[model samples]
Target: MAGPILTAGDLAVRLEQGTVAVLDATVNLGRPAHDGDHTSSSGRPGWEQAHIPGSHHVDLLHDLTDPAALYHFARPSPEALTAHLANLGIHDGTSVVTYDRSGGIWASRLWWLLDWIGIEAAVLDGGFAAWEAAGLPVSVLTPDSVTEIPAPALAACGQPASVDNVRAGRWVERADLERWLRDEAEATVLCALNPEAYAGEVPTRYARRGHIPGTGNLPARSLLAPDGRFRPLDDLRADLAGLLADPAPIWVYCGGGISAATLGLALTALGRDDVALYDGSLEEWSADGSLPIERGRADAGR
Candidate 1:
């Protein structure tokens, strides 16, 4: 399997060889407007204005999610994802590279989704910001049409572990999370929300405020350097010292699974493969009147 992280320079060379398909997976998760609508502004317009040459835009909100789901950004079924990937020209043999303006935050979500479906993909380390910083070229030209690619057979792709199984490699769902939280002894739940959001001081798209109970806040931005690249592994480990002490399972979640995927990628790079993403994240947890949520920080007794 290809590693989850790719450098901007490395991608440029791959593009020259016509060996990779790049997707701009940017999405803005800023606070809602005064009207209180949490609909995220799509990054498609920005990608149209400027993006990596030959890269296509993938709309997480529209194309990749289940349109029928009650929650925003719900994971689409494998059949749905196969169709979307085929339309995007992403095939079983294609090498996928995803990036976003906000570091690899949104890009990692696409990478995680691809991984869940048994497609090989990598996130551009540092994302578009770093690509520009390296004096790489950008393009305003859009492809006239999406190139159709052959999607792998569902059986060939292999069945992804049930969302109820957290012991599998990199993806988790609400039911799995609920079960783990009830009697978690070998797992640590990591919340990727910012301090303000985690503390319930800011307005969120969800029905409730704060984070999932028993999770510790590790604000998504904290994992990045000023330049948007991931922090050094040693530095990252230091910041997560409390959780790193134990060799237990680590489950990460964010507002709607995007930022949590970012943390998941970071953890994978740091050689922690026990990490899994809570797909519905707080989007599902908060809406239910029954699921418990917590405000402020308590020691995440790992």
Candidate 2:
């Protein structure tokens, strides 16, 4: 019962209990340099320089994604994710808290993965910045400084005994969106990318610009405060008013699956558990010339 989100102070207390496993899911993308693409690099260097005590770096770029996936950050198979978590010393009943150096989107991506597989995990509010702002301890110890934690032998250790069933309930595919477009399914699809990308107003790394046709724009960054922490629940509820009022199930997506996960975490925190994320997102959708895409504002006609 830890959280879908945790404050630095709360995580600090949890760390003291010696049962918490902290993972730094940092992946630097389009920052300190804007390449106008989804290209990214590992945040391991940042984590090695300074991190929360006893924390381990989980490279989202390599460790948690599908190696053979055509798009970046595709959700790894359940067996793969289970092994990864176990290697991080996570198992049943292990309280996990994830954080990152940039905007907390990466952390939320891992949190979303855990939530998908029925494991309880939380994102650190404000991420590393908040921890440092609170004058909490930081460490320069590399991941190599600590002994590798062996994966546990339990059949249901860090993942559900039935991982396949749990994963099926949380994700949507490109075909599902196609069905929605054709009116075969009832769902509200929202793009979690920024306004520029959503509108095809800027150059992008994807095969094409704009977004999946008929999807509304809900920039994921809008959900965060200036300091990078998620805004208050009441404020979020206000922004999500229309979607919440709608009876249809919600589906969210982004450039890849990274930023969308931020929306996913926020929605879950607001008690809207019916949300599903499109892992392929624009990376998959835009590549297919056969699929329809929309440019400009969804409500411009209004």
Candidate 3:
């Protein structure tokens, strides 16, 4: 298979063979507004202390990203990305797999970035909790040194999102939210908020529970392996492709806006150009109470 999802036990075989590279894509939002210090790459120091054997930390926040795109962080140029991947010893032949402490939600960022660069990769199923439950080996060793090499130049990423693309792509709101329940008019608005919040639940700190109306439910966890990583590409594609068949936009969001970005990253990886990120996310949507808000039955994910 061009892309394959691996189980914790299966991953053990790959590690022993030394053909695949394991990466930690964990991210945490200490503050609802942004992914914080202990959650991102720079915070990845923990991986050195313990992680999947032979696994390298992808440093979700600090590395493998163009922070410059952010009003707060500078985006990374194509050159930066090339060098970044090289440092991790990534090659066209590398079979990349990732997982994190958080639900595959944040780890999706890693899965997406590789695909953006024309590299193939997948996330671990279930995640770390599942891995530990399986009694897989964990390690605290750091490779002696990492040599940075640049990959082919990267294409521009993280562009502004549009409603038309979202309306015409494969995506679903996290849950039926107040904005949706308030009235159909309220539900049919631009994508930028975490509908989860309005659902009257807080599945993730990134947003209020509830979501845009008429959205499907595909929680990040749906793509996970028994060990916390995402499923293989075939499986992942099968899940999302069905949604795509309908010609609906895929608008992803999470409170302050990082997780949705992660979703956008994932869609972009799966060869979907119509995907978009609600960068403003919930932070912007909640700002205007004038915007209709409705509360509806909450689906766990989409």
Candidate 4:
């Protein structure tokens, strides 16, 4: 309820008043050195070098994901999330602000995850880049020096602490996607990868190449400006003109549910609430030999 997005200046004001807690959710994903190994580097080191003052680092790669999940960045169960949030000193009314150094995709992913539950939080517009551009102060203090705030006694009581308001259908699993394809549901499935990845025109780390069958291409990076901030609402409206006019629910997926969040944030900013994010995305989709994937482009969408 508080935000899907917050400007850097606004966040600064809130920080001045000690009204919000900031979390750096940066995770650098690089092309794998080998065919089977992942190349995700945590942002904690970067956050240690420089970060927004009083901000703590959240491990999106580990703490927030289910280790037992089949793929990377899988959504953790409510119980796991509750304990994780509690560990981070987050409870019912804590004002949370999330940001990332690598563009705003990772930050957007965290925001979407928080939104999936009952917690209300915001993603800092332009993320840490914009914060620095504004001449705001940065801190070198490590997380260990920071004192942990105790969660309220009622945190486990199913108030705001637990996933009391899990946004049903906000997260789409592989089965949900398969069901949509099988039933020919009136939904718009979107792939947020670039044109090359969508077309299987380049090397990919995923088990399979190309995209899910029938998905329209809407690269998530297209939603951001050169400054790594979201584009103007007017520009976004023009870009999404056709899709905005459609009544069907929009479902988005990326390499591993990371970049797709940019589309989710953009659509939410446009006042369209009928959006769902596929968490496993191509990471899980491509691994299965039975699932269908399409190569080449289609004139299905602008």
Candidate 5:
């Protein structure tokens, strides 16, 4: 079962409630440094300087990713994640708020990833900018005596669905995926992309370009409302349920296969099974030129 999306108006109702954890999930890809200083706050540091009175830091690139494979997917280690949540006093029943500055695009990743890991969480509508516009309370002092507790059980990578698992059922290679979507493969279901990165063609940057051939272009943003919250379950069901009804496994993708994890999370929230995200995505496929890439409506880069 899923919970309601908590907007600023709703969060205002529980400004200082019990056992609520606010997470600053600010993640900005490598940008030119304004100065020669490497010690400067990478996003999480700003949270320390000033953030929601009791907000905790959840660095998307660091805390949520695995060091061993960080260079590869830049994802966090399972142990590191379990410990990170514990430090924030997060547990099975803790209420969670995850947010970032990117119009809920990246924020959606944290929101859904937590769900994959079995935590009940949601994104703060409109992020910190919205919070500031509404005059919410913020402080520079870090939380005191934050406790970290290991999970009774840990699943590496936030329990994100594996590429192997998604290959089953209605999924196909680029050409097949296109045929399925184009009425060529008999699949009239809805589709999703792994992340924003693969929506455009970056041939040399990735193993391939574009998404599964016939799949509908349901960008991760499709599941979210303009307020930066997930749409109502009924609405999600109406749109996504049709895609799954055709019995063709709904396929998802992105560059390195990380965003696909986020897409699978949405499917879980909607209670839709029979769906899979191609973890290899374009990155793995493009590694070899023999693989083909198709340009659909999704190929138009943002």
Candidate 6:
């Protein structure tokens, strides 16, 4: 994989030279739920209000996801993703940069998706916050309308069966997770929720509280510094020391699936290719009463 991260200054230079495709992959994770509306939220409105100049908006919830999936943040089929990418002017030769306002959480989500499909992409280290802090330019200008490709026209793109295999390698299903819980599989589970959520002190959108059994609390925010940039590589390694010492495959999960990707990106940057994301995450895991959820921070010691 190419370098997984880029500095704001480097991206600015690329943007000025028109050598790279920039995307504002920002999603407002904290959007208030509307009464009787359970659908996922988006950050496009915020992007329309203010964004990096020349950056196109990618709605992770609507544009890049499988709308038919039972849960939000589900991965889209490769053909669907390819069409979406082509519509956004991203293709085989395009070098892509992704960033978000909430640190790099949402940006990493798109980065991971692009990576799975063999596209060269990177996340802005500190995201929009860092860019603005450096006095970089911002724009309220909407992107030029690209011709929408009909679903039939997309069929010629050739769908590959390998897409499912690629997704299988990057994500873990609930059935596989159950096997792991029964000691039938070998993997280390990591909870990417905030300390409050992990401890069961804060209410979450999930059906239940707390985390899965035998998982460690490594909040996604801990991977980043106060200034929003990711911590130094050595420091990141230290923060995840427990998982690093274990040879078991590392599996990360969060409330929906957004924050887990942040952890996935961080692990990937450390040169660990054995990491996987629980795409359904707590959203699916907690909804089923059959699965056990442990409360408090006691289980975090593992």
CA lDDT of each prediction against the hidden true structure: 0.77, 0.82, 0.51, 0.82, 0.54, 0.79
Tens digit per residue, CA lDDT, model 1, 194-220: 888887777888888888877788778
- Which digits, one per residue and each the tens of the lDDT, describe model 2 over residues 122-228? 99999999999999999886547873232232223654334553555589998898888889999888898888878988887788889888888888899999999
What is candidate 3's lDDT per residue for 1-302, written digit by digit as tens? 13434467776666666556677776544533432222323537666667776666666566754565532212244456656766566655556777777766555656655554555566665666667878987766548844222121112232321122212322333233443445442322233333444453444332234444444444444444655454566777787675545454455654544455445645555765666444444544444555443456444323
Model 2 lDDT at residue 50: 93
Runs off by more than 4 Å, candidate 6 = 31-40, 142-168, 298-302
**Where does model 1 exceed 4 Å of error?**
33-36, 142-169, 184-186, 299-302
Q: Which stretches of candidate 2 lie over 4 Å from their true place?
A: 31-36, 142-144, 147-167, 299-302
- For all predicted structures, in order, the TM-scores are 0.86, 0.91, 0.60, 0.91, 0.64, 0.87
Instruction: Report each candidate's C-alpha RMSD, comma-separated, in the order given.
Output: 4.4, 3.2, 8.3, 2.9, 7.6, 4.6
- Per-residue lDDT tens digits for candidate 5, residues 128-222, read 77787788876775468442222221212333222222123423355654455456654333335533333443222444456544445667766
Any runs in candidate 5 off by more than 4 Å, and if so which? 1-4, 30-42, 70-77, 141-208, 223-241, 244-249, 256-280, 288-290, 298-302
Best by TM-score: 4
Clashes of 6: 0
Q: Looking at model 3, which ten-residue stretch has the lowest summed lDDT?
A: 147-156
Q: Is candidate 1 or candidate 4 better by TM-score?
A: 4
The order by descending TM-score is: 4, 2, 6, 1, 5, 3
Q: Supply every candidate's count of residue pairs whose N, Cα or C atoms clash at under 3 angstroms.
A: 0, 0, 60, 0, 24, 0
Which ten contiguous residues of candidate 6 have the minimum total lDDT? 147-156
Per-residue lDDT tens digits for candidate 6, residues 214-299, read 88888889889999999998988886677677788888898878898999999988877888888888878888898999887853
